[model samples]
Target: MKVAVYPGTFDPLTLGHVDIIRRGAHLVDKLVVGVTTNPSKEPMFSVAERLEMVRREIAEIPGNIDVVEFDSLLMEFAEEQGATAILRGLRAVADFEYEFQMAGMNQQLNDDIETVFLMADVSLQPIASKLVKEIARYGGSIDKFVPSAVAEDVRRHLGAGSR
Candidate 1:
């Protein structure tokens, strides 16, 4: 089976994240959505919350996709899942710079697993979980960036109802 691991914090799955998940699924027998914690940044949602949110968001997607929580190195997680590829999405030049370095490091760790990049749809390219949280924090609508269900999740989490 051609398995790919799409790893991310996914604090709140955005349309861009969904876009990549949907598209990446077609390229592999299974797409493991690895939900992990980034100690460098404070996350608005807990690891459990993020896993549940990603599970809910991708539940309707048609593919053998699953979400798993990990706190160790990404390459180790991917290998544990039997993934032969690591799927990623690029939104802009900024994303490329970061993903590029990460991919290089991942390759060094495991040359057997290749990293694949997919560009988000033009319309969804601007949507990001960080920006979505920021906008909702300030009482702005996030319906455009995230699904209605996720928007509600964020609003409920932030107690910024119906903005």
Candidate 2:
């Protein structure tokens, strides 16, 4: 069975994320969505909270999608999880440049594992977790940027009214 790991902070899983998850689902037998816990950036949601939100959002996806929180190197985690590849979503040239370097580094760490990059749907090409948080932080509507459950969480956390 082919398995892939998709790693991200997912402070607030956005529609763009869900889009990639759905697309990545079709390409692998199982997808382990890793909600990375980075101490460098203060996260809005706790690791468990972010994992729960991602789990709740992808519960309907058919291909055995699961959420886990990790703090160590992602390539190491992927190896331990027995994933054959790391799935990533690319929205623009900037994303490509960043992911390319990371992919190269991951390859250096684990020669067997490969990185698969999926292009985000054009409608969501400009959407990002940071941008979504920014919009929510200042009383902007996020109904279309995040799942209904995630949107609610962002609203409550950011102290804004629901869209």
lDDT of candidate 1 vs native? 0.92
For TM-score, the strongest prediction is: 1
Global lDDT of model 2? 0.90
Error of 2 at 25 (Å): 1.0
Over 1-163, each residue of candidate 2 has an lDDT whose tens digit, in order, gives 8999999999889889999999999999989999997777778888888988999999998787878888899988998889999999999999999999999999999989999999999999999888888888878998998998898998887764433
**Tell me, what's the RMSD of every candidate?**
2.1, 2.4
Per residue, candidate 1 scores C-alpha lDDT tens digits across 6-107 of: 999997889999999999999999999999988887788889989989998889999999899999999999999999999999999999999999999999
Residue 141, candidate 2: Cα error in Å is 0.9
For lDDT, the strongest prediction is 1
- Candidate 2, run of 10 with poorest lDDT: 154-163
